[model samples]
Target: MPQVGSAHGGEPGLLTRVVEKVFRFVRLAEFEILFVLFFLIAFILFKDLMSRPQYNSIFVKKPDLDDRWP
Candidate 1:
């Protein structure tokens, strides 16, 4: 059987290397990453709010019954 810490025979596996690189990148670009995430979340929320009729009642005029029929 292989040793617990020697699963890859003392070499880092592909997944281990990828995870380490991701962590290192995140640590280096923490502020930029947070800003992007914040912007994306805010944009999604704004879009969702605008899509709801109740939220945009003041901005949009209600169609009359005659307009719908014609």
Candidate 2:
């Protein structure tokens, strides 16, 4: 493995070194990047979730398919 934080030329210890590489690539602070990335993925996922319109149980059901036409 190419050691972490090598790109920034810092003599950071293990934790700081990992944080440096992650911040470089992910564009967020070490403490916040995980939440940011998680929300980003969840946003993309829930974007697709928005169109799911639940109807009355006795009413006509819409064509629910895996293919998205939008």
Candidate 3:
């Protein structure tokens, strides 16, 4: 009797091994990954929101005043 799949007997395929390694890495760095992603998404959203015309009104321009005092 011979194996039907994979040259290495019943071992997992290349993609399966790569996926497993990625999953393991993600599991170990889950918190760090989530934290980075959260900040990244927030930054992107903030940048997008600030680019809108409505947010520009939030900053009021100060009028120029004379430097001399009475």
Sort the predicted structures by TM-score, highest score first: 3, 1, 2
In candidate 3, stretches whose alpha carbon ends up further than 4 angstroms from where it belongs are 62-70
Candidate 2 C-alpha lDDT tens digits along 20-70: 787697674655778788999999987666645553433555676886883
Which model scores highest in TM-score?
Answer: 3
TM-score of each: 0.64, 0.32, 0.70
TM-score of model 2 vs. true structure = 0.32
Total backbone clashes of model 2? Answer: 0
Compare the candidates by lDDT and give the number of the best one. 1
- Give, for candidate 2, the lowest lDDT window spanning 10 residues: 51-60
lDDT of 3 by residue, 1-70 (tens): 9977659888888899999999999999999999999999999999998888778657755455875653
Whole-model alpha-carbon lDDT for candidate 1: 0.91
Residue lDDT tens for model 1, 1-70: 6778776688999998999999999999999999999999999999998999888997988788777574
lDDT of every model, 2 decimals = 0.91, 0.70, 0.87
Q: Which should have the higher lDDT, number 1 or number 3?
A: 1
Per-residue lDDT value at 34 in model 2 = 82
Task: State the lDDT at 13 in candidate 3.
Answer: 86
